[model samples]
Target: MASYWRTPKPGRKIPFIKKSPVENPIMEPSIPTHFRCPISLDLMKDPVTVSTGITYDRHSIETWFEVGNQTCPVTNNVLKSEELIPNHSLRRMIQDWCVANRSLGIERIPTPRIPVTPIQVSELLSEIASASRRGDRARCRELVAKIKALGRESERNWRCIVSGGAGRVLSASFSELAAGSFDNSTSGVLEEILSALAACFPLDEEAHWHIGSPESLNSLVLILNCGDLAGRLNAVLMLKELVSSLDADRINVVADTDGLIEALVKLIEKPISPQTTKASLVTTFYLASSSEMTAVKFVEMGLVSLLLEILVDSDKSMCEKALAVLDGVLESKKGRETASDHSLAVPVLVKKMFRVSDMATGFAVSALWKLCKNYEQERGEGCLVEALQVGAFQKLLLLLQVGCTGTTKEKASELLKLLNGMRGRGECIETVDFKALKRPF
Candidate 1:
């Protein structure tokens, strides 16, 4: 019979070594409940061998390492642990366990098996990472199965590898999965991939506030290229939070901005659909506000021309949002400079002032007001009178007669005041009765 204490290896402390055998062996004593996993507090799975020759619950071992507590729980000897690839299901299981325990008012759960050896976990993660590097989806899936078999023990290390450094192997794998080449049969796998990436890629407020690594830009570009808008929106929100500067040389800030502009323009080019239009407009707003290079690129991409089209489009909301953005530009020094050229954009505004829709006319008059004021200090009053000559006063009268009844009146008064300055200076044309313009019809 194998003696219960048959004297094991020098460093190895196999708990089952001295236990019962097949025939007539003494019944193995029941381990106290306290010997169970501290995390799950259940029977430990695949207990890992630690450096000090002791064993512990795999999940508990991971938790200790996460918060810098890598010493063997029983032996109190330093134990090296491995870097983890994020496993979403295991993490959620652990999270669920924690939640359940907390509600039951448990304070601390005691671990039984020493966490799996760090070397073991690292070996598993390396295999998955290697598969990702080789673009071997099959091998990666196999490795995931092995890690998950460890149950909650794999959670922490899995998170680490998935979202760890600027260049994480697990993140790369998830990116590949998001590319849609993966079989739809494995969307459950895809969900895991996304969760792992999210966990690994949490925003680092300090790191972000200073400057971002090129890797951050790379991740964002991947997210943007994907067809999933929810994922894209999440990535955008992350960028907003980080406020990271893009590597202009490698990333081509201008081209990316142009692409975003092109997408927005395509969304609004035809008769705009309510859902897609709203989404596109929101996307445009995000792009406009994202970086300085964004607005500059929009101008370079001739977006001003398209914006002019939307300004005249039948949709009031679209025109209103587009003009509101233009208004922002006008308020800026750069926008002021851009509008001062006035060769093309100004004529569009001139044409829009006569538009039949009250909303369109309002936007047109408001934009003109900003443009007129922008050059008011530079071009002087003659430029303003010339603008009025191009049918500014006539449109103002039309707005006053029909469009100016409600909200138009306030803007009419403002335009009258703006035009009133040009009255005595520019070859003044007192077309509409000033008293008629002033009266609330």
Candidate 2:
């Protein structure tokens, strides 16, 4: 064994083995139980005491109220109100603990910013009203900026501003600006006002009525036509909200506003952002879907081509919206004529049948069914031939085989039958590969 295990030579120097010093592991400090929220069991960042005398994070409590919960999380008792009082003492204690545990990688929380009160908002509005009355454009601009800043600070501040009658004040100011002579110096002030109005929390029913009034509605239309990009975007957002809350009569009023449809169409033609484009589309859909005459007006404003363009580039959700608008537009004779006039219209609709969601597929099928049912004969068999050439017949048959909405299946079956009946004596129909109508997937 000694011979097998060879040893170092007698003249060889011994190797030095210097051992490293043992490292002491840093220990994390334990968090105090009292500093944690009862609900989240995490350290409270913005602790606020609720009516139930329980301390929770402000965001958590607010969310609890937002989701229609009216009881305390800890007690499960009915909350008298959603009021939250800032727990300054507890916050200070938590800050002190953070400072003491700084070596443990704890961050010091900054002082929480106080939300603007309704009284402050009311006073600001009064100043704006007075400035507007005195024609003090500079002063009105300053006040509007302050209000906008406060509104941007927090959602709570936005609610405070709206509750303080900011909507009514802004709408009246817009009306004054619209009715008066155009002043280049005051246009910026008007834009600021529009921004503030758009930033307001969802308007209540009363505020909607105020905005949908003749004066306010007309002024908004003017803004949409002439304001800068920011102003126009805000105007569209406001109009969307207003249209949603308006009754049928108010919708008619909006539909009748001069240049409103034209302005929305222009926005679609030159979109600033996807959000603005969607807002315009939704607003248009709401207005058009209100009445048949409204739909006709939208179609007359050349909405079909813009919608088709949107369909070409839009994602799944936007395609669904575009198809929905198309369905509404096709409810009128003018709409059908415009759509059929576009060379890519039929082909695009056919492509979207199975390319997007089931909802989009249903809308596309409905549009095609309506077109074929109404104008297949009018186009003298050429329309049917064009659809077949574009593989519309193949897609329709595939749609029937795959899982789709019931309405889609029915419409597809009907269109297929109609196409088959019309394919008599046509060469293209004979060459068509019926067996190849399998799902693309």
By lDDT, who's the top model here? 2
- For model 2, the stretches where C-alpha displacement exceeds 4 angstroms are 1-28, 49-56, 61-85, 118-140, 162-169, 247-249, 290-301, 405-410, 425-441
Clashes of each: 16, 0
List the candidates' TM-scores in order. Answer: 0.38, 0.78
CA RMSD per model (angstroms): 16.1, 16.5
Q: Write the per-residue lDDT of candidate 2 for residues 1-441, one digit (tens) a residue.
A: 011112344554432212332333465666677787766566788899987899987766765665566678878898877678899999999999999889788898887778776668888999888888777877888898888888777777877788788887876676565555555665677778888888664777766766776766777777788888898888899989988877887788888988889889888888888888888988998898888899888887789988998898788988988898998888877787788788878889988987688899999999988777765445556556667767777788788778666788888888888788766534343256564677677
Candidate 2: Cα lDDT at 204: 74
True-structure Cα RMSD, model 1:
16.1
Per-residue lDDT of 97 in model 2: 93
Local lDDT at 115 for model 2: 72
